[model samples]
Target: MGKSEAQTLLEKADKKANSSGGWFSSSTTKYEEAGDMYQQAGNAFKIDKLFKEAGDAFAREAECREKCKEVNEAANAWWNASKAYKRGYPDLAVQALSQTITALTRAGRFRQAADREKEIAQIHLQETNDLRKACESFERAADWYAQEDATATANACFKDAADLHADLEEYAIAIERYEQVADHSLTSNLTKYSVKDYWLKAGLCALALDVVTAKRNMGKYASQDVTFPSTREAKFINALVEACETGDVEAFTGAVVEFDQVTKLDNWKTNMLLKIKRGIQTESIL
Candidate 1:
């Protein structure tokens, strides 16, 4: 088949780039010109539905800008590459985003790198539907934000990972991440009030596993936060733990009902507790 217009343009751009001192030693204007040609080729490829080629061209444009020390422009070009790859090649999209993140970080743009990390986590969660990968990515993003002293943002990312782990029924991992959220929140005056809620979530996740784990976590929470005091939430968790220890389905239901009457359980918590109740009943039968 004859070369398509996009392919022809890309070949011409490559030849021009090679003749003009190549990628490594090209003048800034020469690199810019090459980058523009590559970008044009990428757009033409997109119109032809040559998605992988489009992505490659955009990535090449990004590389040229990166060599020129145009960090922001390179980051944008990488982002475009990711967008181009998203439709037919999700893994490539992720790779492109990773490059963007590395470029931004190398330029000492920590905040932007943190944001890009979060975007990568979101892509793992929403596009790839890989909960474990999403959790891992979120944890990395949280660490980056924490390094920058963005405690609230870090806590939020940790919470998101914890929630995803909970959905995966990885209760222990969920509990650990939730505790991290609580621990971080307690250290910041602005987020102190939310600590109890995170601890409550951690306690609930532990309760889903076993009463002993829940109790152990309760003690740990008390030790970690000296200000931890008994509240209705604490009482509710304690009651559930006691009921779970005894395999008392009735008592478990009663405790959940009582708590629901006051501070209503969300749908997810309600479903998890109901499943636990069923498990207890089944065990009693056996």
Candidate 2:
């Protein structure tokens, strides 16, 4: 049987990789060169639209680099495999990214792992539009950042996950994350002033759940942040909560209008509040 083109390329790559005193030799330079050959073969396979073959070649390159203790290079190779897989096989791409994250984390590259996690989140968000997967990826990134003591980045990732959950109407999760952001903010003098805003957002998420839950959450937040002063945002949230508790549609509309006249709700907030109002109206009809 004739050797196929891909098989021939793989054989050549293997030959080059094993040339320097075997695959486990301590010669970083030789392994790097071998990795380059494998990468070239992978790229060729990718151009030929043989995604699985390309992914396999890139995985081999990553393994070679890992054996050489070139952790960063190995991670990059894995990431490249992910990109190649992304073109035709999203599930494979996700698997490749997971491998890259594991490699990076094993190398104690927390920041890089976090970055890769963010990429996974983007893949989930943009490619698959899988909100649950996207949220989980972002949460994983936040966890990695927290491991590295990157508080600001971690908090940002948490906020991103929270917003995605809120968009999916996972209000309970959103509330938890919003409170986390607020708590983290309060821990830093520079961000302390912004805590109230997050708390308000959390309160809004709670309000989306039920009036009783919202009231309980409001009390919890108030107790958590004793320094949280009276603000228009707080007032608006309180009014909304009260209206919801009473199931007073007219009062809810009035409160929203009054708040808008004073501070003007953004489109997202307006939409969210409108949804709550619509729910109240529907309940009244029922």
Candidate 3:
């Protein structure tokens, strides 16, 4: 069959599959067939030096196969998306990601979905400065786990949104959200207390807000109690103190770099770092 006939056939198949509403059990066969047709069209397009068309066909095939839970097929779609992204077709990349997200979401693997969503959000933030939209995407992602009452995951989403907001200098909203996570009442979840990892996140957020507020207040609220921050908190505090003491942007940037290297924090590490970050010369618990 000619490439035009094959493309037409594939398009019809895709419309049928879409009408089925992604109910994979009923449409898997149709998707599998459609995917094969798309592949043939994609190959034809590639042979004709139509990389863009080839990518679109491959991406569509991947999306169809992904809905059918064909992991290899889904991965291939992402590979095609990468090719498209490399070819400077961000729209194709976005399409590929959309399919990937659908697969991840349907599989009930929310963490992966959240990660992908963040990746897309980052791209949007970088490419278009659509921070508000990025924030919305993050919120949707957080809501996914939040619906499951996954406090840790939800807190992380909130934290990311707060950071973006901070970047926009929306400090008050950022601080409030940070506090909501940092001061999350685990009074019900005492099991997390013995587990220093959990509270470390809380402590980090608190320390950051305190420091941010201090800077905003020109040291009016600067307290010495920023002791024992989580390892993550320690980095920021260490950076701030070093920045103040040495007046080195490099050292200061390193200290306040936001990503955390430590997954958990020891109580001692958390406390000590928090104190120092808050301008306390020592951990003299008051």
> What does candidate 1's lDDT look like per residue over 139-207, in tens digits?
888988988988889889989999888888999998989887887777778888888878888888887
C-alpha lDDT of all candidate models, in order: 0.85, 0.85, 0.58
lDDT (Cα, tens digit) per residue for candidate 2, span 232-272: 77778889987887789999999989988977777768868
Q: Which stretches of candidate 2 lie over 4 Å from their true place?
A: 1-33, 41-57, 67-70, 83-90, 223-229, 257-271
Q: Distance (Å) between predicted and true CA of 31, model 1? A: 3.0
| Native-to-model Cα distance after best TM-score fit, residue 45 in candidate 1, in Å | 6.9
The worst-scoring run of ten residues by lDDT in candidate 3 lies at 216-225
lDDT of 2 at 7: 66
Q: Is candidate 1 or candidate 3 better by lDDT?
A: 1
lDDT of 3: 0.58
**Model 2 CA lDDT for position 228:** 59
RMSD of 1: 3.8
* Candidate 3 residue-wise lDDT, 78-193, digit = tens: 65654555355655655666667776776676766676676667666676577887777777777776776777777778777876665554656765665566455333464324
